[model samples]
Target: NAVDLGAVLEQFSLVFCRLKFIFGPMALHALDLVDLRSVLHITSPCGRSTYQVTGSSGKTYTCYKSCHYCSCPAFIFSVLRKNDSMLCKHILAVYLSQAMGACQELSVSDQQMCDILLAKDG
Candidate 1:
């Protein structure tokens, strides 16, 4: 059976573009099934504005609320590369946790914690 290369390429391009729009510019096909389940844990030792997200992959990434930045590959390759404001699943999970008040808050110094809170509020 002969494969139609042009047709295949076109289909692939369409799917890629759709995924890019949905999951930012990163080629995160594996993350298509990502959701709150993809996040293993959330910790904020500094404050609410700074989060440490542990994904299902067991890798921890830093997320900043002030700038909506995540140190994950998806964010680095997609959001930062494309200059997009979209957040990755891990960051989204953090937002969800925050909304539900489920994030495990860690202890921080009074000054630093106050600074972070002020920064977030202000």
Candidate 2:
């Protein structure tokens, strides 16, 4: 994966610095997801990777590492529309997963990935 942890952490701190204290609780939740190993790193045979996380609600959310996106309502309402924060807790979990090497890697076919991504509900 060649991801430099230091660089990723630096970027996280830099981006999150702009957010307010309201998002503080999400950090703990993100760390919990990482510690619990709820993050999944699914890769296809072609070397493309996709990120997904299981929330406390027992639903899986698709997270995009390439564009820093998550298919979570908090991300859409708070992070994007309201601009309450730069990233969702799930996205934070993704970053923490990368930095801590806490993700469960899975190999799936392109068709499986498509089915997973196109799913309306997890």
- Which candidate number would show the highest lDDT if scored against the true structure? 2
Candidate 2 lDDT score at position 14: 70
Q: Report how far off residue 55 is in candidate 2 (Å).
A: 0.4
lDDT tens readout by residue for model 1, 1-122: 24788888889799768766765633353343233344333234543446666665677666666677766777777677886547676676665566546666665665665554442321
lDDT of 1: 0.58
Report how far residue 71 has shifted in candidate 2, in Å. Answer: 0.7
Give the per-residue Cα lDDT of candidate 2 at 86: 84
The CA lDDT of each predicted structure is: 0.58, 0.83
Pick the TM-score winner.
Answer: 2
User: For all the candidates, what are their Cα RMSDs to the real structure?
Assistant: 10.7, 6.6
Model 2 per-residue lDDT tens digits across residues 1-122: 34798888888787656432546888878878888899999988877778889998988999976887888888889988998788998998998789878899999998788876763558
Residue clash pairs of candidate 1: none
Candidate 2: Cα lDDT at 3: 73
